[model samples]
Target: MALPERNNEGFLENAWQWDKATAEVIAAESGISLTDDHWEIIGLLREFYKQHEMSPPSNRLFVKAVKEILGEDKGNSIYLMQLFPGTPAKTACRIAGLPRPTNCL
Candidate 1:
């Protein structure tokens, strides 16, 4: 299958183009070997985008949402950082085929 189109930052240009394969490609490009835990966050990010019409604007807000949905253990910043490394919200959004968080730089 053809690769989905992506922006300069490697986010999918069209969110509808996202799929598990595409997400794996993006994750691989980012040096991530996706785990079940990573997929959990990606699914949550996609759902969050569907409801909010945007990626969470800040890490704090993302963490809060995760806490509310997945509980405190997964919602903590350190755990998220461990999963996504540099910037959990931005990295997960990219892998999830969602737009970059407006507040992220």
Candidate 2:
């Protein structure tokens, strides 16, 4: 299937075009092979976007949101960093086919 258009930074131009296949392609570009753990966060991010219509604006907020939902065991920076290297929120939102976090750089 043809992939959806993305911005220069690799985020989907239209989040509505996202799907599992699209996510796999995007994640592969980052050398990530999605596991159940990855899917857990991805699912959360998708639901978050559905509910809030935006991604967490920064890594700290992202961690806090995760901690609120999944608790500290899986929500800490170290764990998220291991699952998604380099600015976890940015990398994760990209892979989740969500818009870039407004304050992430």
Candidate 3:
């Protein structure tokens, strides 16, 4: 029931690292182009974490999110999968600068 510890390298080592400046570090490491849509999702993830203090479930990540802010139309998992297939859920969390999720383990 516990969450995974972030990479020893340090979670959110990228854009949001330990502080807001860490987001720059994350940007450099991600090597992927983060667009406005991506920022929208990441910001939502941060807000979700702030409210729940937990990562979203991978299974319903897109579904759960879209309904809340951007609406159900944007809740497709395909976009998330296409965007960060290598890490999909995990990398999304990384880009969002959140701690690793429990299911990711």
Candidate 4:
């Protein structure tokens, strides 16, 4: 099943309201600058809308994604980690602006 399209304006009025501290934690752990470039994959994942109806495997996928987008010769996990640390899944998902993950339990 697909996730309901969130195209409605103001639908996010109560979505992922990250405070300054939470945003900072996500940034510090993920190292991904909370910028447009960092948001590309998140957008892509949002569109993915897996059968499970949730965000994709973020931390695990970040490495492979970097390699695919930036080039396999250049997308190393250690480096990506420096850029997006923690579980990578957490960092990626949060930055992607998706909901917090479930398996993160």
lDDT against the true structure, per candidate, is 0.91, 0.95, 0.62, 0.50
Q: Tell how far residue 76 is off in model 3, in angstroms.
A: 0.8
Q: Which 10 successive residues of model 1 have the least lDDT summed?
A: 1-10
Best-matching candidate per lDDT? 2
| Per-prediction TM-score to the true structure, in the order listed | 0.95, 0.97, 0.69, 0.46
Q: How far is 101's C-alpha from truth in model 4 (Å)?
A: 3.4
Top-TM-score structure, candidate number: 2
**lDDT score, candidate 4:** 0.50
Q: After superposition, which runs of candidate 4 have C-alpha atoms over 4 Å from their true positions? A: 1-32, 50-52, 65-76
Model 2 C-alpha lDDT per residue in residues 1-105, reported as the tens digit of each score: 678999999999998899999988888989999999999999999999999999999999999999999999999999999999999999999999999999999
Q: How well is each residue in 17-98 modelled by candidate 3, as lDDT tens digits? A: 3433454456457676776776777777788888887767664664567556777666677776665565565666776778
Looking at model 1, the pairs that clash are none
RMSD of 1: 0.9
Query: For all candidates, what are the clash counts?
Result: 0, 0, 7, 5
Model 4 C-alpha lDDT per residue in residues 1-105, reported as the tens digit of each score: 222233232112222453434444545544445655445545544554343456655555545656676676535666555545656555565654456555653
